[model samples]
Target: MCPRRARCFNTTGPCSPQHHYMLPPAQRLPEARELIEMDRYFVLHAPRQTGKTTPP
Candidate 1:
């Protein structure tokens, strides 16, 4: 896993060097689940063309 600035890839949409955010579903979902179980609010911010959080 990277402990530094995440490398990014270009997609068929607006993108910039600053929009370096990306994560695997395998990685992000568990973190979301933990926060939900604890009743803590959090935001899912990702780069263009990524998952949209919906309440399960």
Candidate 2:
């Protein structure tokens, strides 16, 4: 078997668990579920370079 590769922070495109170190998207907005369940509309806002455009 091949040796495990090292992971690094992802700077572009979607991140992969095998190649990048990242927090799960869900953890970033835990309240989103509650808002959705209540039938409320909400917007996501964050500082630049915070992975806002990255897909969950």
Candidate 3:
């Protein structure tokens, strides 16, 4: 793992849906609500190693 990337290894399964309650707003950043609500057309872009890839 690169030193710059956050450690995301899961001992069990991927993150739980209820985990959202524990996430701080700033930590999640721009948020996904507005993007889905407004029916907006846009792209979400970021540099590599920035957690931009969606879970499979």
State which candidate has the highest lDDT.
2
Q: In angstroms, how far off is 11's CA in candidate 2? A: 1.4
lDDT of 3 at 6: 40
TM-score, cand. 1 vs. native: 0.35
Q: Rate the local accuracy (lDDT) of all candidates.
A: 0.54, 0.73, 0.44
Worst ten in a row by lDDT for model 3:
16-25
Give one digit per residue, the lDDT tens place, for model 1 in 1-56: 32356646444454444544544455746786777789999876776555354211
lDDT of 3 by residue, 1-56 (tens): 21343444333434433331123333565756576579876565876544343342
Top candidate when judged by TM-score against the true structure: 2
Model 1 root-mean-square deviation: 10.4
Q: List the lowest-lDDT window of 10 residues for candidate 1.
A: 47-56
Candidate order by TM-score, highest to lowest?
2, 1, 3
Model 2 per-residue lDDT tens digits across residues 1-56: 21469887666788777777778756877998899899998887987676666764
Which regions of candidate 1 fall more than 4 Å away from where they truly are? 1-26, 54-56
Q: CA lDDT of 18 in candidate 2?
A: 79
Instruction: State residue 15's C-alpha deviation in candidate 3, in Å.
Output: 6.0
